[model samples]
Target chain A: MATNSLPKADLTSSGRPVFLQNEIECSILSSVDLECDDIPNFPLLKSGLLVLTTHRLLWLPDNSSSSSSSSAAAVALPLSFLTHIFSTKKSVKTLFHSPRVRFQASLDSSKSVVMTVVMRGKGDTDAFLAKFWENWRARAWENDVQTQTQAGVGSSSVSGSGPGSGSGGFYTREGAVRMVGVSGILRKEQEMWESTDKSLQEAFQDLNALMSKAKEMVILAEKMRQKLLSGSNSKSSATNDDEVGSKEEMQDWLLSVGIVSPVTKESAGALYHQQLSRQLADYVRIPLERAGGMINLIDVYCLFNRARGTELISPDDLLRACSLWEKFDVPVMLRKFDSGVMVIQNKSHSDEEVFARIKALVTNPDTLRTGISASDAAMTLGIAPGMAKEHLLTAESKGLLCRDISPDGFRFYINLFPEINTDDVYLVKDYGIYNTWVRVASASRLE
Target chain B: MRRRPGIGGLQTAAAARDQYRLVGENVAKIRTDMMKEQLATFRTQLEEFARKHKNDIRKNPAFRSQFHEMCAKVGVDPLASNKGFWAELLGIGDFYYELGVQIVEICLATRPHNGGLINLQELCILLRQRKSDREAVSEDDCLRAISKLKVLGSGFEVISVGKKKLVRSVPTELNKDHNEILELAQAQGFVTVEEVERRFSWTSGRAIDALDTLLDEGLAMIDDGHRDGKRRYWFPCVSSNSTPVADT
Candidate 1:
């Protein structure tokens, strides 16, 4: 039973695929079968969901019986191996049966037939078949491989040429480079001008054209990041403080846009949300790790859509994809607060842990004296200010902390209410948390 | 002889049954009588105390002044002129038991140390005095005084009926030693003689005399720590080498 094969793909925690850095999904179909006559032991890859991507032919199981052994196996057929794609023939029999597109490809040394697939459920099947052919011929996976090699070679070559000689301004005829004053401003302007010019030109092209341009944009971002890194390294001795600051800012901007392949609705088709959801799950890993295991859904949407560039998904699509996380064995989950604010958090993200950290933060002598605002918590927690506010609010609800709303802003303090002896408000016992708070608060008042 | 019935068994069983019924009736009658006697005693004591103190309560300048002050502080009119007016206004009838218990406890606790038992009349006078003082006494302060009093004894008696209210102090033998009192005073941040007097209802002369004695004996001292003219008194329990005792 294990020897049988099916065209299937795995979904990420956010219901998106674990796609290669440059591999993009192309089409999706529900209630499809992978039938073959030659092999007797070939397990019936019964009515499952099939996905076509730029690089692989993927099949996923139907929603009803997804728990079966067949669904557990997701197989991919590399487009690089496909030698030919036979066009869909129009016949009376074809019209009667489910719409199927057959293609001939070389598996190892022999020619084999693989058919795909239109079990059209609320989607355009002919359109998907057309895209399937286009993606196969385009050979996006090959392009990614070639670009990676090109990037490797380019970096080595660019580094080999020292700063003095490599300074060929694409915007100006400055064969000679200067380090200060007007020349510095002119150089910075020229660099920005050329990059902006390239991106602008790419943006003006047709949507299909941008798919290829997106690769260049990714390459450019990577190059900029590398340049920033190397520049900081080489100029560490001579670089002034302001130059270093700007370099760091530029590096951050470049790093944010570094996602090479973002799944789009056009590519993922009817399984748009599911595939997008999976991709989102993979994407959120780094951000979630940096945010201490949780991130607001709105922030994820902005980051995801920004990384996606032109193929931004709707909020509804993002939500549906998040809602589907329960069905997959992903490491992250979608959490909704009582305030109706939603967030994507690691499955292991515990309130106890966050509350403990918050408790520590607010109880610090300095923080106790001057309560922490959302921004202050954001800086300390290394997360967005908005996200920090949500965490503080969560901690507040759990009674780990309390809020003080004042003209200055809303701030949080370690909750002393529970520890306080309301029966004796003035009685600060020497061996209790309330005593410590009173001491700290009094010290601040003196100051 | 074998066939004859035994008179000893029959007579003994009959006597035992009679004794059991007699005992049960006696128990019930005693419970009823005890309850009636307790009620009568409480009523008689209340009435006698009220009758004895009624003229003094009305004519006493200090009592009238204190009552007026309390009424003013609590936002009620003191000059209502009705006899039971204060009782009705303050809902003392409902709270009389609790207030009486508080007074008795305080008086008992403080009196064992030769601190005069503060009756309801004296408590009222002290509160009134504080109200008239530049620094007015808060309700919380009054309640604190009452609470401290309760720690002395199990039963603190108060009687409230119609417009008449009487409080009698019953001192107990559970007075704290001088060391403990000094510690409590320091912990409460009662530094100056005036502060101690205000907190414990000590006369100005008595508070000063005690402070002088404590300082002379070196058990306590007036530290040089003064803020806004309020000198902070320090107890020897807290090491002078450690951090200074802060106001808070």
Candidate 2:
């Protein structure tokens, strides 16, 4: 109840604090406490993660270390409310005691109180204080407000910015001369093309320039996607199949176009791999869902890099990031096949689900005779061919399937090795895939 | 409710499709332009990074592999031409190309016995023995070269058989019957026709036909001197404990 005095911070699925728009994390200090001696009912937040970001000071419970108090939620204090920071004094008494940074913040319009942050972990106190001061002075939240107003002014019609935009038609205005029908669409397309040409020209000016422009390009992509989305929904009954299909494709490309603040070595320093691993865990959830709870590491590398846009990490860095997941309590894991192929999969991913699908595939009458290849499983599983092959090989090892290699190429069939009665190869089981395969093969032969 | 089922409907449909196509073209153009820009910038940055850290990239095998991967994404083929800067700076191109040629030669030499199917571990040993330098060739290196050899056609491939990688250098086909027999022969180094028939629920004739095909292909051999008077067909290619590659 005392903790409710401070505003709560939202957490990602992987336990990372959900940052405000353009709020970049500056530094992280573990095992820190926020104490307010001025307020009687103030709860002394103890031994948690304190993150310094451009807009706020985030306190997240150390999920890995605190098993007993796992319910301890994260909280955020905006830098805008800070009135002053009490600098450390160089005294023998202070030197003996734990390093603490005190600051004055207003809880509401009437009450203002002094708060203390005691650092229990091994981190640079001076650097954290410097970043705190810098961030408080920088006031990055002001920029968000400016961009919000600008975006509002730019697209008065496209109010909803996310994937779930409302199904409002393009001609939704009342007083302004509205363009209707085909000519209106053509004019709108022409206007967008001119702006796109300008942005493209500006973006390609130089690499440094491109990096700065990446954010704008992502916004532009999102806006265009929203336009297409609403355009599709409003005209769903009037559009042709190819038009609807292509619009959906464009939406997909735009959806995966940004990761606003990707973790870089320059940003996270010694915690680079750790932070990257957490971010990757959150990033791969959507792609993993699309890929049936598993994806090849190589495919993830391409997708992650594409989303990151400019700050490309090496494969070694990616491997290290993925390997670090074992130390963190993330829902995703790094797996290595017996053949040395690596993949990122959800911890909840069950081989039995994949085996069941492969079982269905191989038992099909046509596939029962000719068998299925990695490509066949890839199409059905909605995963990469190499990943599908790994799944197939896993199923083979599990005795769910068997391999067939010949001029027709390497393929898999339902494993009849177990179902076979070695004592009498002539005897057919009344049940099992072997019997089904035999019946299908015999029927095909008869045909 | 907005359905039009006449001439005017067709016109509107055509106009809507045209508008969609126009918008789609613009979006595609923007996406491609953005991609091209990113790729170009990444290429320059990669070249600079490669130049500055060429020593680290060469000395560290993991770093070298990562560098190769980064180069691959930016449309740079460091191994394309040996006369270029990548060759002079890295020399990884010649290293893999030479290894590739040696792999081909070894595959050709061992074809008669292995039936063009050899264990990847065995192939790496042969490669190391054939070379005199202190430079070590790993299975990863061989795999990379083999991937590049894909340009040669469908004759070369790496197949996984019970946790073992077998490099197939010939275009021979092994159907379901042949694969099952090979798998059954994996245990105890060899299998009898009776075991194969009993295990696969196949008739004696079916088992013998598969075993005979494997024998004729030189992938297996018949050992008739058994105490029970039962013939054993041993598959050298599929056997894990056997080191027949040494004698071959």
Candidate 3:
């Protein structure tokens, strides 16, 4: 009963591994184990779900098989630390045994061990090994380190030029002599413009060139966003309203730029829908909160796709992903109303909360007199009009509200049906919404 | 290339300028495409980062507001037109517009018993029953379409009394006094002069005037069958359970 000493990987709320900045999941295999016989008292690395990414190999406990073993946590091994991967040998003896891929990796600066990955499940062992080799050779983690230093240099040079003028620093004359007179300032502006024009021309020579420069443009946009964010926070007292407003506009444009590493069928294969379901659960939390714990499935599709940029998922895929939520322990659920409207809602979202809000709305003197339309409830509840209507209907079904149909249009009022004393047609209760409504109605009469 | 004076020189200058402009436009287009691709890639990481710091981002009212602002900007009001991308895609605008016509038909058909004042729930049911498609027409849909009917005239507008909305298709304006009496009558499906006066502290004249007005409008019925000496001004329009079938 030896404890594992491997570094643990951080998992998302839905148990997906937290990926590095540019790390992408390349392949996945279930019921795989990583064993190091070279080290004594090695932890019992049992069959688990092995995820191969560009930067690391992540092993997560098979959720189905290890449901009761809470102690078996996910562990990660950086591909960067790998020294060599031994190719699988084709032999009669290998055919008799479970396919295994052995690799030599440095556990630390001073220690190295030969780790064997035992593939026990019905998976393409050869394919996993090929990817293991590809990822190890790709050296994706090196690229990340390079980008980090590059971004560091880029930002430092940006701040080093002068105090940023918010998003208007694009025309910043970095190395030119500090201009004094207006003519010198104009010359500096002209030179900056020419350099910008020349760079734009060079970047646009062809699509391939532009594709290569795309990463730089993204970094530039991110830098601008950071600049604006910091500018607003730091210079809030000194910035004029117009400058702040323009900076906000720039931030909006940059904020919508795009998302990365969407779970595609090409990458995740059989796990596409499951991973998508988890990714969706994580993505929808903010929007669900902003939408008051419930959002239309169609709306989520639109927002999720918009955030994902070109990696647009089909509505069918979206539905499959949503339906898969039931199998996971995610906090969100997909609900279909009686009218065939699909919605994703937080598990904690209660109809009673909405009902209570509707009740409060219907009892308002103005609402009591005029009733509330779906749009009225929508406005008050900060939800879509359609969703608000569904809530209003649910409230009506619960006898919390009643509808009025007229030439004026459809509206809802607090349900006075249950409060009425049917035994005595003229009886008015001493307390309740009905009584309060009656008082408001009568008071309006005198006015 | 520099500016020239001769006609041929001018032509060459114009051609050079045109070439430069074409390159500039090409670069702009390419830059935009690159930006979109880059943003798409960046968006995934940004969204993940945002999710991790969701609480902090949510607490930043400005961020939430900006997100909502974007949503608003992209949101198309399907009801705004019957022929547009949204209309063609979902046909929701047409659905509601057609539902509105069906609603009118139902109101007209049920006008006799309900007296142009039908409950929204009943209207939806009747509208559904009349349609062969029986397309799911919700009270909300009916409300949205009915609101659109306001353009027809003030005759069609939703009026609320007590805890119920009774659609009044007729042009008659039910003033505050009439609404008060209707709401008071809701509790017991009827109200007497004594109750109205006591509730409003109104003189008998004000109470009786409103009651008589409701009676003349065919909205109220005289229910003197009670053992008590007082006559109950029964508002069939405001009553939840008592069908107007008997009175009509």
Candidate 4:
């Protein structure tokens, strides 16, 4: 591990970065080499996917190979420790060689080492280098840690020095500002507004300027969301319901405006779908749980696109991404109904289980008499009617249920078809769905 | 005068008297022809009465029963009274409504549209005609007609109707419409005012009002609505096009 000087990362069970509460992904790269010549036993850690977040640089192994069978491990480098980055030397020798970046940092008091990042994959090396430089210089991690500590300070105070203050010696006298109490909070807000105004004015100056400020805008949105969350929690009783509702809506809007780390063609390149596939696997878990372990592909598309904010993926992309889940050890799988509608369902979600429940529901005297519509099933199943329809249809296909179309509406009944002997429809034998249905249906008809 | 000329002797005079009597008889025959016209008129009136009574025999149950008794008295067979014959005399109108219902069901199941499809108008017209008829359509007649229609034969499947009713067969084409409507309704917890408007291309408020009518009539149902100000309407399912409001 020491030999693999590449920073390590923590991944969720589904392979997504276990982002700090407010931390977000910024950019991604593939087939990168983080080499420290000073460390002898460092792991080679070659050709892995690198994700840059607000707080850390994360690396994950390429999953296309059998090596993925190795324990799901990731490496991360806390952006807080980054010191100086060396600019690329564009000599004839460097021009002929693979694009590389060199950075120097001290891991301990005893020594500091120069790390070389070799870009072996086909990507915009220049763009990556520029972003890398910007991220390093922006000191976003310091702000994140500061916010994190402020969050830890409870609802009472807002003053705290950022974690990277050790490097504050580099700040010019004009950059220094001492903040304390309510006045300090107001002054900070003022400074933030002036900075935002300056950036807005600069952004209007040119398209290139706006593009440069895009990351800053995302950061600003994140900060606003965090501030709102903390504010809402602290003043929980002070705000009225209407204001709270609007704030909640605003919070939702802000939360969905961007995915701090969108897997882009620029980052993952040829492996875009694979990485996107993994990210989707991680993303769908919540919605899947909410939907009771399954969801329509179209629904997932909508939710996933919503969660991704502006980076809306196409249906084709979503389909391809979902298809890739088969090769991975993901918990969700794609399912196609007999009706040809596709859905995403948890692997553990068994139709037999849903069928058993539906069987119970339809066999109930009330449901047996009224017959359950898709909505009724949806209500009982705690799912969308669309999803419930799929389940009901599946049950229908399995001959576990049958459909009734009448002047009233379409509904599903326990498959009295199987229970009713075609030879004698009126012959409702004891101890069968047919007999039960007849008893209920007859009573209703009589009524 | 000819008889007098023919008479030559006293005996001949007797023969002449007989000839004159014959001529007088011919004149009387002409008078009789004039007088017989009244009898012919009376006979014509009797014939009209018989014709009117024939119609009465078919329509008026009492007349029919009396006529049947008279026919029995007169040694003529009376028409049989039974369910089968009654159904036959009622013709196809009795089954038209049921057929129309099945057609709508098939169309709805086969191709789901937002609404306002040209085919839907045609189907609605057909259903309206079936519904307007005073006679209740029998399910069997509808099923029979559907079975006979070549185009619908493959696509339609018969579903047993309620007790005492004939089985209603739906066309597979309606499945498509059902699916589309279901999908649209599902996407919205309830069919939204916007969705109704979009589907029907009706005025905003009108679409919502119409949807409410559909809801109230039990043709559709509201499953859920958005918490946001916008109201969503969910349909339990599409209603049978030919079903009377009272049936629901």
Candidate 5:
């Protein structure tokens, strides 16, 4: 066995491939073998899940595969190497043979080979071939590569007055006559309404129409992001504070409109779940970072589906996907609390930090007086109430806090248990939290 | 020139040592006697304090309980014989004795209806009616009085089923199964045969049998008024608004 020098795809800690900018997964096929007839030392790449993206084609060893005999290492083939794709054969001879799609690709500029994509798995071979051509021609990554140079032009025109230009067309901001403050805002609002009105009209024309518009929608989102980025950079001094603020707000809204070529059941076939899991592992990194490194599984589901737009996954699928994270070396992980509450947290997220925060929240004078309910902690921590409860319970188990179950409902207070002198219940030490509590409690009793 | 330091000289020194030993013994005896004298004085002082606060000890439950704690630390049982200097001073012994007598009367009165098992709250209600504004009886006072009445027999005791205190006025001993049924009934103040079946994973027959025994013992009441037609075995012994019953 010779050392196979195929391009190694970098996998996320959770086992998802690190995607290039603007690259999106188009389709996936299981039990695939990427073989080049002319290249004999191409490594015995047998029966792995093949994923086609706008930028690259990736192959990962199937979980049930006996690839231990071969180099089961995942490999990526840049789509740029794909010189030509042969149309599928629909003859009776093709029916007798395994379904295959052939294309010309090169590992480098000098060596080219006819690559055969053997799809032993069951799926619409023609549909996969169609998407293969569609993404190849779309060339989404070529646009991302030119981003730095196009940035200046991208920005100036998107500032409400450029000549209806930038990013080759779809979802480009056409422009309004340059104005200041209120009028500019009104014009921005008018432009937003017209875009919505136009998209809605096109979306409802028919299902096929909506499906065709999907790519345009993704491109529009990308274009808006570019415009916003440029609007802030090149025209920061020119634009008023309010204008910049609106642009920033728009940037946030458009930021998550990705997963452009979401892996669908129809596209991914039997590999739907495996591909979806990897995609989810990729999608959750940003939101998980913002949510203090921990978020309820339900929140992740809602956010992931919202960002995905039309590619909504079931709760069962989300759970299975999250569970599969254990097998991969992804940066984020799924954590199930003792209370059966499931959450996603960054692998580097320390419970000690959360406990420290909870300790601070509980010991504050107002909190000491009234204590904190789960909802109150949620408001302070900026998380969902249910997730906050799980945190509170964790803190309680760690002995950082104690629960007070009363008619008012369950609340948590800083654990003053250690400070309390059980030998003499009436005695309050002159220093420490106990005396402070005693003073406040006694004073409050008079009121 | 002054002292022989060895053997027979040491024997003469032993006589002096004996005399010093005698003196130390005498001193120890006197110290012990002094301690006894101080203890006697302390007891007298405690009595005087009790006399000073006799009205407070009698009328105020908080003050009375505090006084009781002080007495307990000194190994004083004021109600031990009910006839003592301590009893005369605070009159706490008589208060408990009176409470006990009233409790006995109420338990006997409710025995026919509740099958010698009654809720503590209902017993308190009856006692208040019998002796209105007398000493302002509390559940704690009732519990203490009943604890004293336990001297009559093992049957006069308080048993808790869930949060409800039941005073069993009969001599029947409840086993674990009966106690568990009562404990389960505490949540909604009542349990049904179906609920018992579901909660304890008991067969319908087993649930009915246990509930029926409780019903027969007057520890529980039955309501057939439910729309679902399930017999709700209401254990007044474990119900929220019922009196604590005592066993015989």
Candidate 6:
């Protein structure tokens, strides 16, 4: 709690704290205060949000509840600093008082001090304390530190001892199970072979075992990704294209399962949807970017559930979470089209940008002849066909495009609705997209 | 390029002159016979094409529409007769006639509830309920069949009352104002003078004038029981009676 002792909390635009690499949020407690008994210049983190993560204990001023807390900077106390956690005391005095958690942490210059976390709100205080202890013992940060120092060669042997570590990487778990400290180079080769053998044997295991194994599976996947990344960076030409392709597929599958610390109903309780919405806003930035600033709600539902792995939320829950985004000042919105199809889009997503793309697509010489189908736009826009259809329809409604319903399929053309002189249907403009369309459409006739 | 004869009569006389001489008449007859033979061959080819893509024509609305376009180009109106060559080949003419007859049955049955003004989508739903799932019809198909019913002198026609398509079975000539009033009443089952004025961007006089006509024709009911004294025009024809009174 000493002044300038703890690292500053990096926050997302929506005021949620930015997690460290491979870090995940575990629990949240509101209206919490962090205080140190001995330190004089300790920052007064009074009645703020307390977030327990795999790597750090983050405390932020609850800007969502109290506007006054906006000026108070967010702070993080890495779990690495903690020396011991005190047990809860039971008494009549404790019942009348707010829940309190005490822990000793060595701050800057190894000066260990006693810090008390006072939970003033009616959050699940006991659950927060229990997660605090569990996270401290799990020591995910220590594993990360070990992985870096070892260059991940002996990663499979030691990190596999952690709870739920059996779902280790396909490379590491199969390769290094029986190997000790031989030559570091020889050990990796041995580990790879062992992993291959083990994977086949473990293929028929019960799902319950695999359920427990999933957590470590994520860690092992991360480790393998790190190794592959470093391998690519150092020896790009040496790695075979086949190897990189398989690695990429493995990474993608593993990355989908990367949201290790999903905000569960049991964890957030009454504030489940609100917290989920905030988390979702943070989660969608990368996906939104990938989808060109917007994605259908159905696609989002699948991606979110896939990312959460075993912690799958219901569609109703996902919808409620999306609906709660409106109440909060988030950077994403849930938009419902005229057709009742819903999508999650970036707040900055503009129809002009999409229309410009559609205009470009429809006005192309090839597209001018045949017109652009929804699937054609979907492929070009890197979006789902249904979503592309919505965009196309929106563009159509805006008169930026017009539809041609025919035997081939439903398609869109750059809107000639305005440029079209209905008084003379046969009159050609002699210029513009409409003129181009006419020329292209009649090219076959001329031939 | 000018001909010496008066253009219309000259062309007619030239046409007759060819038939006057025996050789000229015989040559003309052969040409006419050849054109007829080509038309017959074209008809047979079209029938084969229809037979080959029968399921496509039946299942895909867009495909069926394309086939219809082709038929139109060849002066072949498949829906013209029930027992014609096209009907024998595809039975599409029979299908539409059956659909039109069923639509007539539905319109009369539901006429009391909607005052002979039924929503097109609702009418199609009722039609589908009466028929099997194999015969899935679209709005365009319904429109086509309904147009054929006009020959019966029954005012079975589709009208756009707002975004909803309303099938008006009665021969009540609905002007734009009356149509607007009916459409306005569609949402809430009733509309006051103020509501109509706000909706159609009309003045109070225009709104009252339209509402008065509807009330006089008995197409709409007058509800002035409220304490506010605002005259509410409720079009029983378009209003399906689901909306509550307080919505106005």
Residues B1-248, model 5: lDDT tens digits: 25797898988888877765564454333333333343334334334444344443333222233343333222222222223466335545455554555566466546545545667887888766544233456798788767655433354556665567777654322123555576687678689877877877754444555566556544567789999997777654344543222111
In terms of TM-score, the best-performing candidate is 3
Error of 6 at B231 (Å): 52
Q: Which stretches of candidate 5 lie above 4 Å from their native place? A: A1-6, A63-70, A87-97, A108-111, A137-151, A158-258, A326-333, A336-340, A347-447, B1-248
* Residue-pair clashes, model 1: 13
What's the TM-score of chain B for every model shown?
0.26, 0.37, 0.37, 0.21, 0.37, 0.38
- In the order shown, the candidates' Cα RMSDs to the true structure are 41.4, 15.8, 17.5, 40.0, 38.3, 30.0
Pick the lDDT winner: 2
Measured against the true two-chain complex, the DockQ scores of the candidates, in the order shown, are 0.00, 0.03, 0.02, 0.01, 0.00, 0.01
lDDT of 2 at A304: 69
TM per candidate comes to 0.44, 0.49, 0.51, 0.45, 0.42, 0.44
Ranking by TM-score: 3, 2, 4, 6, 1, 5
**Highest DockQ against the true fold, candidate:** 2
B87: Cα error in model 3, Å: 20
lDDT of 5 by residue, A1-447 (tens): 323546888866545567776566667777888887777667677888787777888987666344444456789988887898988868999988889999988766777778888988876778878878887887756767555445455445445443222112223454744444433534544455456447645743543443455434333334444543454454333425354445355335323434545556656677677667878888888877775676656446545644443344555677788887777566777876553446687877767766777777777665677777654565465553445666888888888888887543467888898888889987888988877777777787999
lDDT on C-alpha atoms for all candidate structures: 0.51, 0.63, 0.61, 0.53, 0.59, 0.60
Runs off by more than 4 Å, candidate 3: A1-3, A64-71, A122-124, A156-217, A220-258, A352-447, B1-248
lDDT of 2 at A28: 82
Clashing pairs in 2: A405-B174, A406-B173, A406-B174, A407-B173, A422-B198, A422-B199, A425-B201
lDDT of 6 at A130: 76
Output the lDDT of residue A26, model 4.
56
Segments in model 4 whose C-alpha atoms lie over 4 Å from true places: A1-7, A20-27, A32-47, A52-55, A64-68, A79-105, A113-120, A124-134, A137-139, A142-248, A256-258, A284-312, A332-350, A362-389, A399-447, B1-248
Off by over 4 Å in 6: A66-68, A149-151, A154-257, A351-447, B1-248
Candidate 1 residue-wise lDDT, A1-447, digit = tens:
323433445555444445666565556676676654543465556667676766787766555345655534555667776777667788898888777666655554644655444464655768867777777777667676687776776577447633333242322323544455434634544564555455635532543333335445444434444543454465333325354444355335324544445555554456666666667778889878875676556445545644443233555567787887777667888876543456677877666766777777777666766677654555465543444666888888888888887543466778888876778777778966677778887876898
Per residue, candidate 3 scores C-alpha lDDT tens digits across A42-103 of 76667887888888999887674435364578889989878888877899999889899998
Clashes of each: 13, 7, 17, 35, 26, 7
True contacts kept of each: 0.00, 0.00, 0.00, 0.03, 0.00, 0.00
**Model 5 residue A417 CA deviation in Å:** 21
- State in Å the error of residue A404, model 3: 13
Overall local distance difference test of candidate 5: 0.59
